[model samples]
Target: MKKLYSHSSFFIFCMLALLLFQSCYKLRGHYGGEQSFEATQRPVQPTDVALPKGYKMEAVATGLTYPTGVTFDDAGNVYVVEAGYSYGEIWTTPRLLKIEPNGQTTQVAAGEKNGPWLGVAYHDGAFFVAEGGTIEGGRILRITPDGEMTRLVENLPSFGDHHTNGPAVGNDGYIYFGQGTATNSGVVGPDNYDYGWLSRKPEFHDIPCEDIVLAGQNFESDNPLTPDSKDKATTGAFLPFGQASQAGQIIKGRIPCSGAVFRIPATGGEMELVAWGFRNPFGLAFSPEGRLFVTDNAYDTRGSRPGYGNGDWLWAVNSGTWYGWPDYSGGDALNTDDYQTNKEDPKFILAKHPAKPPRPVATLGVHSSSNGFSFSSSPAFGYEGQAFIAQFGDMAPEVGRIYGPVGYKVVRVDVKTGVITDFAVNKGKTNGPASQIGGGGIERPIDTEFDPSGQALYVVDFGIMPMTEKGPAPRQATGVLWKITSEGGN
Candidate 1:
């Protein structure tokens, strides 16, 4: 016999249906947006691809910290760098480790908090590491195979949100690294309007304000000097202003940072600028043909007005070229309107000035945060000359206060044809369900590298984000290392 449901029970059923419908709508909207593109399907369990047939994958290691960079030595030993928690703040652990083929791990170097160490490369029998800093900025550490370490370079401008990271050994034998700007979009003063010491308001007089102290201004602001005025500007000589007055221009820049790629001689010398105007280049690599390529994180517009989906990019880098940061992203040309308000336009006399034409080989998902990448030189991987890139998930919710999460897996790209296909999936029951969560998964894999045999690939999993009122402690173990190998077949 059929029974009538209670009023409360019927209401609850209706509410659940409405919630499910709303969720589907949101997912559809997200995938149907301008950033939508064809992505490779992921498998629930690790699956192998058809690679001529005999090659296989084996888990060499597991349970690692936030491993961001990996490389191999001539002796077949593997080296990995771990940035333990603290990240951008003043309390992260920076470590360099060596992993043997037998799964043995050894710590080579360690630093204090906020030391976001990333990017390691083996060259000329020595290992170089990129140590990211906050107040003191980033530095390149040189280490011998015997575990001896020394600071090769220091005092990089890392106070900005994005610091210097990612070091690569170029075919030219020079060590290249990236140094990011301190401010977002080149604001000349504090972002806030509060009259407190941290505000970005201009000074009442022209007596060398905040901008002069932190980042010196090449010229005076709107106010000028008169022969006999109460607050006259000093000519030729610079003078200090009150601490409160100086706060306005502390974060200013003559021309907002285009971001830069620099090279230091293998034998040690001053770092020379290679390319400029990149937003945050997290990955750099040279193809088998010796061409330079860079992976850049796109700009976020949620904090500012009239936001645009500038889009992340994969650029074929050339010396003296500009990739357009703070002004442009993707392949769009730079325009006057893109500049930050209240700032002067950069001088455009140089040949590379006014933004050089950019031609990206591939367009990563918007806000995907693509990091380390390596060319699949091993024929065992099946795709000879193909490139593998790691997506560090998205961080918009933490920084930009927006949500545009699409990529959470490794992508294989055909550099010549601009074609991208999903290469590997990090899905499992331990992470979350297989069902789509707003068209994306939750595993935040940050870096990828092929094993010495080239039959298997290693990926670093930087666990879940901490949600408690008090975040995870410094050096907390919340990271994992996963190995992906071919199970066999097309």
Candidate 2:
């Protein structure tokens, strides 16, 4: 086994080198898009990855292209979705696949240009998905087992840095999802160029679910829509490029708003707003007690607003409550030096608080990309009712600088006390990805789920997506799907 592992590693190394050489020769040093690399895949050594005793891990599927979420149907048939798009604007046909127990996979459905399909949930014999919709507007779709698809909602405001995400079905028979803001803070600016959407949809900006009175704060930056290299313009929250809102200006809010949570009938109908004021509410799951919990990505130290020194927030959501965005973090006001980065001092964009924002249950790492998660309900898995979140790790320099490697593992968070502890991480003296630490246990675990019986946990690994000065360089066919079954863990 050892000899076989070494031989496989050597082969991957050679292949990567050749691919890099070819890309450089063809692109003449362009780093974004037009370049494809393979993620180095070694055998999944259960012992090499640190997990609780009595729990064993196995790589059930490999060579997936940017997989985002994993789920299982009523009959215990496992399914996973390929995002079809990555941070660097690498777009392909998004797909849903069924994985057999032995790891063989078959395509179930294919999506259109509206991609980076963030997630899928199986409820009532149909698969519901949230399309990122970078090229077109975001949409919610339901797919039958035979591959017929229908649009439940369309023209959702997703032509921004973030897009439509989630569809976590609830006990109330509703499908809930998140719509992310177009800009980092409230204002859209040049920093959004990294997302590869601002240039395509210059008029696209965030829309509030309820009318908001602006503070009249306008951000000035190079207008991306204009051909002039230095044509500057001022932008404000809820307005397009070169548009500004005056003090106390009421921007009319509407349903299907950006930076909010929305729910629709399982059978498809009018979209209803659940809550608003999240910057990028990425992951949504329900606790055993029937409460919706969300993992929201914190404001980055980029963009025109550029707030600093705050980690991600995990909240037990309250219906119709405004969890502060563009103004607060972890229940603290952003209009203070605590959030001021070297480049910008953040200020509240709204004239008044919608209401005192509820504090997050727990805080995850900065730029950790604390995405898709699930609750462990099985008595055998331990930590029953606790969340198992996949920390996709940080995109440093591009997102911001980190003290050390922040999150590249799975963690369990206690809902009551807001305490977090490592459940699964790469085995190393120092924590990092396998590519950085010469290990192959795990890389960028994007989502987590348990089987219908709750006896096994499945993890989706969206493979190597390295950040460069140019932007994110996401590789293809480098993802992995892992399953962890427990005999009994206490």
Candidate 3:
């Protein structure tokens, strides 16, 4: 990650301009007013990280660029992935990296595809990568140890606010991945414009995995694509702006649909739907018992269908099942006064339901951004069946207004009882990223994995990417990799 950014004057000027843009909107009261992007003087050592009573955290590697996930090969060599995009419109080449025991890192592979590569996994002799597809489109790629790469699936609808997330290889020898929705809920609104994608991909919109009938719900917003300020567009769910859906209107679904989970042969073949109706199911992993689980990032209080006080979720996957999206959270309908983010209360946009959505395994924070997770299986790990999830934290103002910071820690969840506990976090009185408190601790952890022996857990920390008002000022080479091991009795 060295030489990626030299703290150039041009970058600094851009950040200042971006800061000025965000300051103008602070009077709204609900949007981000003040922020912290200044680099901290205190370098956070592993000892600065807080862990449960009997565990210890150590720094394994540092100075990575937007590192998202980590994996291990058969020989026990460590591998990590760097997501290419930083969301504040910062773009860099996504890379696959191999870490040596001495702490030296080598770039195993670099991507040509549009990025923010969310996750990766090793199956057989190759690595499966989830290309975020922020601009061109989401894709799944198979890469060898020597850097050769091949696309297994392409053209996934992920050019909106979200992207393609997981590539969890199931025991069935098929690669399962999650495709995120484009808009906040369904309708393309001015919020999409703020995300900087709606204008670029004016025709881009969410696609359903199967045929669906709409309830004719539509949202009105000033068209960002049009030059006229007064021109408005009435858009419906799953359709582009200016396109309207009537009552009982049908939208055809295709294979690589948005807001759904799909599977394809590990070697590459026909893509099949495992489940549908997820907002942005970012993380996917299989438990020791073979049950598939995912972490779904709940809706933000933005866009046309924003809902308030909704938390992220963890779900146990079932084939041929429909987990609620847009219409529900935690298996409950969204049309409620409590969930009302704007003037009118939100309501169901679908004409019919496929089936009753199941209850979530557990519920996380409202803006925790609960993401990549792994189940603890080895007895040495102590948690056994519990799952450890990395909360990437929240992006205020961009996502929505916030009273205080949320997430920015690791939590252990008891899948059986649906209970949760903080596992690893920054040493702070306030729950937020290190930048918020000026410490060199876990800033934003994105993903983690237990070693082959299960004696140690490797965490991928997405270093300091703090809110700079309208855009995030993500520092290159700020990412760090951490390891956790049992210290004593638990």
Each prediction's RMSD to truth: 11.0, 9.3, 10.1
Error of 1 at 76 (Å): 1.0
Per-residue lDDT of 82-120 in model 3, one digit per residue for the tens?
998867677888999999897779999999749989999
TM-score of each: 0.70, 0.91, 0.91
Q: What's the lDDT for residue 132 in model 2?
A: 89
lDDT of each: 0.56, 0.85, 0.86
Q: Candidate 1: global Cα-lDDT? A: 0.56
Pick by lDDT: 1 or 3, better one: 3
lDDT for each residue of candidate 1 in 88-162, tens digit (9 for 90 to 100): 132445677788667668887776654678788888989888777653557788888777887777876554446
Report the C-alpha displacement of residue 256, candidate 1, in angstroms.
13
Worst ten in a row by lDDT for model 1: 191-200
How far residue 210's Cα lies from its native spot in candidate 2, in Å, is 0.5
Please estimate how well model 3 matches the true structure, expressed as its whole-model Cα lDDT.
0.86
Ranked by lDDT, the better of candidates 1 and 2 is 2
Candidate 2 regions with alpha-carbon error over 4 angstroms: 1-43
- Tell me model 2's lDDT, rounded to 2 decimals: 0.85
